[model samples]
Target: MEARLDLAGSPVAGKALKHFIAANTALAGSTLPRATRELVEIRASQINGCGFCVDMHTKDAAHAGESALRLNLVAAWREATVFTEAERAALELAEQGTRIADAGGGVTDEAWAKAAEHYDEDQLAALVSLIALINAFNRLNVIVRRPAGDYRPGQFD
Candidate 1:
């Protein structure tokens, strides 16, 4: 399958994505744990049905030493025992944030509080930005029907 457009080749999309990538790089330096970041990205992509992102993040997670079991269980994280409390809280936030329209009011206070218990202010900022960034990428990929399963770890970096 072919993407409807090559995002990197389009000046408009390219400019926007450059800023997006810069934002992501800044977020990457935040105190949010790298493992949690990947899990949250994967979970949000899963919810959004963005196969391209799911493939990219899953591979990236694996390359970063995330266990296969944990990767496979991200979708069912609520029922899984492999996640830490902090990771669980992040996952809850990611879900609520990604499904904002379905929930009608966006991320709940309870979810935010739970995440707050685990993250510092800077970490929270990164977590929020990562959620938004991943969702934007998800929508772009989903809309283009980007094919999956060919991504390599660190392909973008």
Candidate 2:
């Protein structure tokens, strides 16, 4: 299916995305582990039902040496045993952060505490920013019905 609009072709969307990409580029230097970052992105995308992001981040994660098993298990991360404790913490935070409106409390104190146990202040900052950013991207893509499966790793770089 075609997207409702070509985001890259629209000046308004394009300008906003350019800044978004720039922000992400800056966030890429965060101390959060690359593997965890990808996992968080994938998990948030999965929760948001943004196929384009899932496809892109999964492929990008694979290219960056994440195992197929781990990638496959991200959706079932709670039930899967392949992830590190830190990864699991981040995933839990991502889920809670992504589904903020689903729960009356937004994010639970327990989830935040768990994440804080695993991440330093800088890493937590990055995680919070990443979660918010990915959710924004997911909403835009899902709203536009952006088709998935054609993304090449680093295609935008």
Candidate 3:
């Protein structure tokens, strides 16, 4: 399926996405581990049903040495035994952040506390930013009906 609009071709969208991409780049350099960041992005994309992002992040994760087993289990991370406590906490926070509308009150104190237990303030900042950023990308891609499966690792870079 074709996208409703080519985000890169539209002047306004292109400009906005430039900044968004920059923000994402900065967040990538945060204290958060690369593996955790990719996992968070994948989990958030899965929750938002953004196939483009799910495909992109999964491929990117694989390029960064993420295992197929871990990538496949991201959707069912809670029940999966392949993740560490820190990774699990990040996934929990990502889910809560993505489902904010459903939860009404947004990320819970328990979730926040759990995440804090695993991550320092800088890492938490990165996690929060990553969640919000991925959700934005998810909404944009999902709204446009952007088809997946063509993404290559580091294609944007």
Candidate 4:
């Protein structure tokens, strides 16, 4: 399927995406674990129905040596036994952050407390930033009707 717009080709999007790419680069260098960041990105993309992001992050994570079972289980992480408590906490925060409207009061105290327990302040900051960033990406891709399944890991780089 064709995207409704070529976001990367547009001047408006180019400028905005430059800043976004910069922010992502900063996050890439953050203290958060790559695995947890990827899982959070994937989960948020899934919740937002942004197929392009799901394809991108999943492929990127796999190329970085993440296990297939863990990748597959991200969607069903709560029921799967493949993840550690830290990963589960991150995933829970990602879900609650992504579906804030559903929760009404935004991310609950329990989710934040759990995430705080698993992560140090810097990592927690990175996680919160990641959640916001991924949600923004999901909105942009979903808005532009970005197509999925052709993304190569590190294609953007």
Clashes, model 3: 0
* lDDT, candidate 3, 7-124, per-residue tens: 9899999999999999999998888999999999999999889999999999999999999999999999989999999999999999999999898889999999999999999999
Error of 4 at 71 (Å): 0.8
Instruction: Write model 1 residue lDDT over 1-157, tens digit each, in one string.
Output: 8888888899999999999889988988888999999999999999999999999999999998999999999999999999999999999999999999998899899999999999999999999999999999999999889899999987888
In model 2, the runs with Cα more than 4 Å from the true position are none
Per-residue error (Å), model 3, residue 102: 1.2
Q: Report lDDT (CA) for all predictions.
A: 0.95, 0.94, 0.95, 0.95
> What tens-digit string does per-residue lDDT give for candidate 4 at 95-121?
999999999979999999999998999
The TM-scores, one per candidate, come to 0.98, 0.98, 0.98, 0.98
Compared with the true structure, the alpha-carbon lDDT of candidate 1 equals 0.95
Deviating ranges (above 4 Å) for candidate 4:
none
lDDT of 1 at 77: 98
